[model samples]
Structures are given as structure tokens and as C-alpha cells.
Target chain A: DAGITQSPRYKITETGRQVTLMCHQTWSHSYMFWYRQDLGHGLRLIYYSAAADITDKGEVPDGYVVSRSKTENFPLTLESATRSQTSVYFCASSPGTGAGPQHFGDGTRLSIL
Target chain B: QQQVKQSPQSLIVQKGGISIINCAYENTAFDYFPWYQQFPGKGPALLIAIRPDVSEKKEGRFTISFNKSAKQFSLHIMDSQPGDSATYFCAARTNDMRFGAGTRLTVKP
Candidate 1:
């Protein structure tokens, strides 16, 4: 497809297990973002990459790590997933021109028991 | 802390009625404000947006009203329909983006 896509639409892992969510976009956007959507919290940014190898922390970056080795791929990893981390994760991309609209993938629903 | 605050955690409106959602922010540095709509099991998609310089921007049945001095903005969906039922989020952008808690709207037929 020509849009953003996330892998393993649904995932389940143990509290101490490590899990990774993959995000790939064909648009080659300059900005890629990872967010977690939970009830009553809307969407909170976990991490974002301005460009390949250039990443920054967002509102809730603890316990979550991200790397953008390629402009088209930005992956998020949880070193030790916790039950509190169970939420729907979304990946988005933007052209990075001031205030450009972001294109989002369907999202990955992760559960940690 | 949530930089953007949204009101009316949930809303219900009859078909053809108007649906309104409000959001407030304290950061004057945020120059762009955008609203996103999400259906069940799907990521949010940009619905409409407006800049602080503009008071109002309308596209189809969706409208965004911005009040720069009050640090507030709103989304108004006219003639709401069942298809319009979804979760809507309002966000403010600076170097990073901050999103409101979100509003779930349900339209009754």
C-alpha cells in the first residue's frame, strides 16, 4: 500500500517480556511518531523521530524506546513491558512542514498480563 | 500534565442535531491546532484544523472555531448523523504535539 502500516495488529505479552511494534510508511515523511491511546487519556506521545537517527522523547517516554534507522521505518520497543503499558499503540507520519497533517496507521493493540 | 484539556467526556445527539466539543490550552507557543476523528479499532484521522490567526474555518459540516485570547478552540459538527459517531481529539502543536483527553460522540438515529 501507499500509506502507513503497522505490524501484528494485536499482541499479547507477559509483564516482564520485551515487545516491539513495527511501523512503516511509504510516504518517507520527515517526522514519525509513536503514541499510546488509553481510555480517559486520549493519545499520549511516547517518542518521535524528526529524521532517520534523530529521535526525541515525548510526554510518556519512560519504559519505551524507539529507533528510526530508516526514514520509512520507526519501531518502538518496550524493554520490560508492564501491565500498565497495555493500550492501543498508534504510529503516525508527517511531512514536517510547520503544522502538517499526520497520517496514522490502523494501530496495534497490545496487552501485557 | 495534559497541556490540552477537552470537555464533555461523552456526548449524545439526535440525528440532524449539532454536536459541539470544546478544548482549552494554556500554551501560547502552540501555533497549530488540529482535530482528529477515530472509529472503533482505528487510529485517529485528521478531520479539520485551524491556526490561531484565524477565528473560524469550515469544511463541509465540520467547523473549527479558535479564540486566541482565551486559549480555547472548538469543533462544531452540523446536522450530525449516525455515521459521525466516533471519538474526536483536539491537539495543540509546538515543537511537539499535545492531545486532549478526547470526546466520544454518539449520534442517535
Candidate 2:
């Protein structure tokens, strides 16, 4: 497709297990971000990548790890998924890290049991 | 403190009526303001956006009114339709984007 896509639209994993959410964008945007959305909290950024190998922590980065080996893919990994980590995960990308509009993927609904 | 605050956690309006959602921010450095619309089980999509330089921007039936001095902005939908029913989020961005808690709007036909 021409836009961003997220894998495993729905996922259920046990606590303490590792889970990875994948995000791929066809636009080859330079900036990619991962956000977790929960009730009362609109969208909290977990991590963002400026370029292929440059990444930074966002508002809520604890327990989540992100890596961008290529411009088109930004994957978020939960080393030890906890029940508190159960939330809808969204992946977005923009042309650059500056003041630009972001295109969001459908999102991955992760449920930790 | 919430960087961006949105009012009216929920709203209901009849078809063809106007729907208004308000948002305010504390940061003056925010140069870009964008609104996002989200449906249940879906990611948010950019509805409209405006810069601090302009007081208002309109696209189709959606309009964004910005007040730089007051650090506030609002989204007004003219002749709102049932299809427009969704959760709307107001966001401000300088280098990083921060979104409001969100407002759920339901338009009944």
C-alpha cells in the first residue's frame, strides 16, 4: 500500500512474555513514532526515531524498546509485557522530525493477560 | 499539568447542526496545530491543521479557529452529519506533538 501499516492488528500475550509490534510505511518518512493510547490518556509517545539509526525516548518509554534499522520500518518491543502495558499501540510517521503532520497506522490492540 | 486541555468530554448534535470542540494550550512555542478524528478501533486521522500565523483555516465543513495570544484553538463543524461522528483530538506541535485527551462527538440523523 502507499501508507503506514501495522502488523498483528490484535494480539494477546501473557505477562512476562515478549511481544513485538511492527510498523511499516511505504512513504519512507524520516520520522517514525510509537504511541500508546488508553482511556483518559489520549496518546502518549513511547519512542520515536529521527532517522535509520537515531532513536529517542518519548513521554512514556519505560518497559518498551524501539529500533529503526531502516527508514521504512520502526518496531516496538516489550521485553516483559505487563498487565499495565495493555493498551492500543499506534505507529505513525512523518516526512521529518520538525513541525509536520503525521500519518498513523490502524494500530495494534495488545492485551496482556 | 496537561500541556493541551480539551473541553466537553462528549457532545451530541442533530444532523445539520453545528458541532464545536475547544482546546487550549500552555506553550507559546507551539507553531502548528492539528486536529485528528478517530473512530472506534481505528487510529486517528488528521482532520485539519493550522499555523500560528493564521487565525482561521477552513477545509470543506471543518474550520479551525486559532488564537495565538490566548493560546487556544477550536474546531467547528458546519452542518455536521452522522458520518462525522467520531472522537476528535486537538494537538499542538513545535518539535514534538502533544494531543488533547479527546472529545467524543455524536451526530444523530
Candidate 3:
């Protein structure tokens, strides 16, 4: 497809297990972002990458790791999943940092048991 | 402090009625404001957007009204319909973009 896509649409993992959510975009955008959505919290940014090998922390980056080895891929990994981390994770991409509308992936629903 | 604040956690309106959602921001540096609509099990899609330079922008049935001095903006849906039911998020961007808590709107028959 021509748009962004996320893998493992639905996942269930143990609390201490490691889990990674993959996000890929065909647009070759310069910016990619990872956000977690929970009830009452809307969407909180976890991490974002400005370009290849350039990433920065967002509002809630703890326990989450993101890497952008390629401009088309930015993957988020949880070193040790926790019950609190059970939420719908979304991946988005933008052409650049300023005044651009972000294109979002369908989202990954992760449940930590 | 919460940079962006949205009101009316939830809203319900009958078909043909108007639906309004409001948001306020504390950051004066925010120059761009956008609203996104999300259906169940789907990611949010940009609905309409506006800049502080203009007081109002309308596209189809959606309109964004901005008040720079007040640090507030609102979304007004003209002639709401059942198909319009969804969660709407108001967001602001300057150097960074931040989304509000979101408002769930349900349009009934």
C-alpha cells in the first residue's frame, strides 16, 4: 500500500516480556512519531524521530525505546512490558516538523497480562 | 500544566443539529490548529485546520473558529448527521504539536 502500516494489529504479552511494535511508511517522510492512546488521556507522544538516526523524547518516553535506522521505518520497543502499558499504540509520519498534517497508522492494540 | 484543554468530554446531538467542540491552549507560540476525527478502531484523520492569522475557516460542513487573544478555538459542525458520530481531537502546533483530551460526539437519529 502507499500509506503507513503497523504490524501485529493485536498482541498479548506477559508483563515482563519484551515486545516490539513495527511501523513502516512508504511516503519516506522525514518525521515519524509514536503515541499511546488510553481512555481519558487522548494520545500521548512516546517518541519521535526527525530523520534517520535522529530521535527525541516526547511526553511519555520511559520504558519505551524507538529507533530510526531508515527513514521509512521507526519501531518502538518495550524492554519490559507492564500492565500500565496496555493501550492502543499509534504510529504517524509527517513530511517535516512544521505545520504538516500527520498520517497515522491503524494502530496496534497491545494487552499486557 | 496541560498545554491544551478541551471541554465536553462527551456530547450528543440529534440529526440536523449543530455540534460544537471547544479547546483552549496556554502556549501563545502555537500557530497552527487542527481538528481530527476518529471512528471506532481507526486512527484519527485530519478533518479541518486553521491558522491564527485567520479568524475562521470553513470547508463543507466543518468550520474552525480561532481566537488568538483568547488562546481558544472551536469546531462547529453544521447539520450534524448520524454518520458524523466520532471522537474529535483539537490539536495545536508551533515548534511541537500537542493534542487535547478529545471529545466523543454521538449523533442520534
Candidate 4:
């Protein structure tokens, strides 16, 4: 079904450069989220959108920007990326919050050099 | 509280054995507790989940035990298998959400 897909499955960027990770879902879920996974921190939410054009900050939103121009697409942009931003980024979506389970993407392994 | 605490940073179990992972939270408003399994190079996928109103829920070889009063929950894998080996994360969802540091599980055949 290609339920959820994330692009640039692997990315390597230099510090201070802008990098964007793409996420798309075919289910047309109402809630989409961006999370970064680190060794000791587990998964930390970066940004979330309730629906198109309705976005909110998450636990770890610094240095990252997100927009849901369409219900199926939510992209995360790391402005002036830093080494600290290097982590496995996961995109997830749920039919609704606290009610339905979130489906996750394979994730994008981003390396900020 | 927004924190969800998990124990045993890692676990090893033999096939046909039982594997359990525990998580505790401080928020009483959290009604949804879910466990996710993540393989290397992949995203975390829902393994099992439970609601506070229910004390336990089971699916196939996986089960979730919830203790609302204690603000704790756990995932139990019966008849552990090698394919079940993965990093497990416990998450509590309220109006806001938080996740526990994952536990890496290794099942030996």
C-alpha cells in the first residue's frame, strides 16, 4: 500500500547547510509527525501537523522547520544543519491522536558532517 | 509528569522463553500506552498497546499489562523467537507525549 514513505533514505550534509527530509503517506492520515532517534534519547518529536497548514512544535523543534502543504506530504527542513542534528529521522501518521496507532516510515538516516 | 521510564537497557532471552519489558509513567491523564519494535535501520512499529481502563490486552504471542493506579505498563512476549529481536520502546500518550529510552532485545535460538 506504500502506506508511508520517507525520501533520501540516507543523507550526508555539511554543517550550516540546509537539508530537507521528505515524508509522504497514502493513507491520508490526519496527524503527521517528525521525530529524530538517538542512541540514549530514544525518539524525540521534532514537529507535528494536525492537518494541512496546521502545524505545531514538538519536543525537539530547534533548528528544524516543517510544513504540511498537502495532507499527504510533510517535510522537515534542517536549517543550518549541525552535527548534533545527525540521527535517524522517522515520519509517522495517525488517523487521529490518542485513538489510533501511528504508522512509521522506514526513516531517513541523516548525517551532518 | 511527561517522563516515561523503562528498565533494562538491554535484554537477552532464549527461544521458547518469556521476555518482559517494563515502563512507568507519572501522568495520570495518559490513557494510551503503546510498545513499538524497531529493527536496525527501520522505524519503530506498533507491537502492542493497552488503555488504562483495561488491565491487560493480548495479541498472538504479545501481551500488554497495564496498571493504572501504579501508572505502569509492560510488554510481555511469550515463546520468544529470533524474529522478535528488536529495540523496544514504551510510549505514553496524553495531550502531549513522551517515550522511554528503548530496550534492545536479543533472542537466541
Q: Write the per-residue lDDT of candidate 2 for residues A8-79, one digit (tens) a residue.
A: 999999999999999999998899999999877788889999899999998889999989989999999999
Off by over 4 Å in 1: none
Better of 1 and 2 by lDDT: 1
Candidate whose DockQ is highest? 1
Residues B16-100, model 3: lDDT tens digits: 9999999999888888999999999898898999999999999999999999989999999999999999999999987667889
Candidate 1 lDDT over B1-109, as tens digits, reads 7899998899999999999999999989998999999999888999999999999999999999999999999999999999999999999998888899999999999
DockQ of prediction 3 = 0.67
Q: So what's the TM-score on candidate 4?
A: 0.96
**Which residue runs does candidate 2 get wrong by more than 4 Å?**
A99-101
Candidate 4 Cα RMSD after full superposition onto the native fold (Å):
1.4
Question: Candidate 1 i-RMS (Å)?
Answer: 1.2
lDDT of 2 by residue, B22-61 (tens): 9999988898899999998788998899999999999999
Separate clash counts for every candidate: 0, 0, 0, 0
| All candidates in order of DockQ, best leading | 1, 2, 3, 4
Each prediction's DockQ?
A: 0.79, 0.68, 0.67, 0.65
lDDT of 3 by residue, A1-113 (tens): 69989998999999999999999999999999999988877888899999999999988999999999999999999999999999999999999877544799999999999
- Candidate with maximal lDDT: 1
TM-score versus the correct structure, for each prediction: 0.97, 0.96, 0.96, 0.96
True contacts kept of 1: 0.79
